[model samples]
Target chain A: MNIRPLGDRVVIKKLEAQEKTKSGIVLPTQAKEQPQMAEVVAVGPGGLVEGKEVKMEVEVGNKVIFAKYAGTEVKYDGIEYTILKQNDILAIVE
Target chain B: MNIRPLGDRVVIKKLEAQEKTKSGIVLPTQAKEQPQMAEVVAVGPGGLVEGKEVKMEVEVGNKVIFAKYAGTEVKYDGIEYTILKQNDILAIVE
Candidate 1:
């Protein structure tokens, strides 16, 4: 299934978090939380500011760090996706 | 208490959620979660994009609606605050 964001919102696919510690210790499911890292897959054209269109700074394929609890979660094609506004993005990893 | 945001981060104080319905019906505590509304109190000077500084679009006193789960929670002077990037802000209430 294809999903498109509305306005300045972006669709992201989260990166899986490590299940084991660096010391090779495995963590239980209840002990781990959803990951905060994601890859930008789709983005809105831009948002309106005072009736003028403002383009987004981040683009598709950017790896971003977002807040753990941000965005609305949705499932498409058996994959989990997140829809978040551009402002919800914190930083783009180089 | 005084708090300063780092980089393009902004600090917001959450608006209280209505405990009772408009019809005067009250919801139970377990049914209620933290409010998603907030007012911008402090903002970072700006963030660097491609070596250029960009100013924030929203200003202090702007009431905004953020995602149900966004921002890092912090406490200062016995008050709770959320620290989020400028992009996390969805819209400014007029």
Candidate 2:
């Protein structure tokens, strides 16, 4: 029931796109853009990847901004998640 | 001027697509398919990239097969080449 990414990969749950305006007006579904923000669900055990030594920097529950159009989309238990390599992540959000 | 790729990257010159038939007939330009094979032109210094320790594996003059649509196409001194990360190279042709 859980996904364990392998070798420098990470499993992330995308933060829901903001659908409400600053004035609390709800925007339509078509107006909601896919957010690049996500919470790290799992971190891969970093070791030898493509002959390189990789060390995982991000930890579980950390918010991050990832590259657009990167990673694979997967559905588990009716929940959508993205699995991507650590390099695809641009920055960790505080 | 020659291009020198940066860290963990490689510059490769794509091999010319076969333009002749086995029967010694010359095929039209439109019939030529892009070849995936290339000769390594320059290799980046092996070092820290994306927080990982990457070691350069391929060397200059080595023929390698790279992933399709990988790397950035660049023209230098009237010649075309591709600059891509080392991971984008799939295998070295013996």
Candidate 3:
């Protein structure tokens, strides 16, 4: 199933959070940092907002970083995804 | 003192929460919805992100709605402000 985003929103597939620390000790779910990396799956049309034109920056295949706890999380077809505005995207990963 | 947002970041002054509901019954702080309306005080320069030019949509002095729990709160110079990226803003109100 497709989760088409509206406006400047985009659908992203989150990267798995690290289960362990750098020291190789396993950490509990609540103790680990929330996952921030994601792969952009779909992008919505970004246009004029408040008399200013807002442009879309990331492409569908780009890997990006999102603000922690930014958007609604949903599970679709057994895959977890997040729908967020493009502004929630912090950075693009090469 | 100035809170100059950097890299598409913005400084906003949150609007006061309504103490009473539409039904005219006064509500306590915990019973009210989180305050989301904000006035844009300062805006960061919208620039290239991930090799694409990301233009800013809202201008200074515009009233906007932000996602719940989207920014870092601070009390500066006797006033409260929230520092968040442009994406955290949900809409601009006329």
Q: What share of the true interface contacts does each candidate keep?
A: 0.00, 0.06, 0.00
Stretch of 10 with least lDDT, candidate 1 chain B: B19-28
Displacement of the residue A81 alpha carbon in candidate 2, Å:
0.5
Candidate 3, residue A52: the lDDT equals: 47
Please compute DockQ, using alpha carbons, for every candidate against the native two-chain complex: 0.04, 0.04, 0.03
List ranges where model 1 is wrong by over 4 Å.
A19-35, A49-53, B1-94
- Position A81, candidate 2: lDDT: 93
lDDT of 1 at B12: 87
Task: Tell me how large the interface RMSD of candidate 2 is.
Answer: 15.3
- In the range B51-93, model 1's lDDT, one tens digit per residue, is 3466888889887767645666644445666778777888786
Cα-based lDDT at residue B23, candidate 1:
25
- Report the C-alpha displacement of residue A50, candidate 3, in angstroms: 17
lDDT of 2 at B14: 78
Q: Backbone clashes per model, in order?
A: 6, 0, 1
Q: Model 2, which residues run further than 4 Å from truth?
A: A19-35, B1-47, B50-94
Q: What digit string (tens of lDDT, one per residue) describes model 3 on residues A10-92?
A: 77887655622322433244634443677898886788433346699999989787775766554444576666878889888
